[model samples]
Target: MGGQVPSKLTEKFDPHRLVMRGTQAYQPRCIALEGSVGVTTRCSIHPQRPSICREVLPSWESGEPYPQCDKARIAHGLSPLAPEDWIRFKDANASAA
Candidate 1:
């Protein structure tokens, strides 16, 4: 099978999981400019930072500020969307044994 090659840019863009912390413990959510926890220097996932990072302006669209990336969905009054939801949806149509 022939397909286009994936560039380094493609490998560094993940839309799914957000990278919270690397191997370090007790890292602050917001970091200093020059310290080890700085935004430009000590990011947990420096390479794969998502595009949505810039679009997260606090209270721009509403009075509530933009929450952390992990809780983005829940902040919008939606559930975490667990896989169990799909299982339950499937079981609704399942025949009795």
Candidate 2:
């Protein structure tokens, strides 16, 4: 997670101290602190970091290779990969595991 103060972790909650993790990625995509952008606090707000951070595949694409899948989509000069394409791309690369 993004070192946020989880409800379970801290009795007193300070949203500011909470560093937003994965889902938090949607939160403006801008960290306020100038120098410490990537550094996450010790106490995480959510036990589960955002999907983007954890690189969790979407429901449709359970075990896809994100980078390869993403690159392939871009190589064609196409838009972002759709969920179904991601699923297929991931599955095709599964044997490489």
Candidate 3:
């Protein structure tokens, strides 16, 4: 929706729906054909992001990381968090909080 739509999908896809109604009722679209996900995986509209986005917390605070974050890291060849990592993360952020 932000960039030029692929010619192949032009006939079958509705770019408007992908861009305007991609996220509905708290469900987010994967492709972000909406352009909400930025190049670095941060929300493009972070300052004005939805309530659900604001409610998500990293593992350190919640005691368990988001499964999707862990899955993505593993898919990219990174290790999942060890107990020590969580301990350190909690220690580091505890003071900030």
For TM-score, the strongest prediction is 3
Q: Residue-wise lDDT of candidate 1 within 22-73, one digit each (tens)?
A: 2123533432113432112343333344444445543323334445632654
lDDT of 3 by residue, 47-93 (tens): 54444445555544466667656665565567765567777867989
Higher-ranked by lDDT: 1 or 3: 3
lDDT of 1: 0.38
The local lDDT score (0 to 100) that residue 31 gets in candidate 1 is: 24
Candidate 3 versus the native: TM-score? 0.36
The positional error of residue 92 in candidate 2, measured at the CA in angstroms, is 3.5
**Which pairs, if any, clash in model 1?**
none
Off by over 4 Å in 2: 1-47, 50-59, 62-80
Top of the candidates by lDDT: 3
Q: Per-prediction RMSD in angstroms?
A: 17.4, 10.6, 9.8
- Counting clashing residue pairs in each candidate, in order, gives 0, 7, 0
Better of 1 and 3 by TM-score: 3
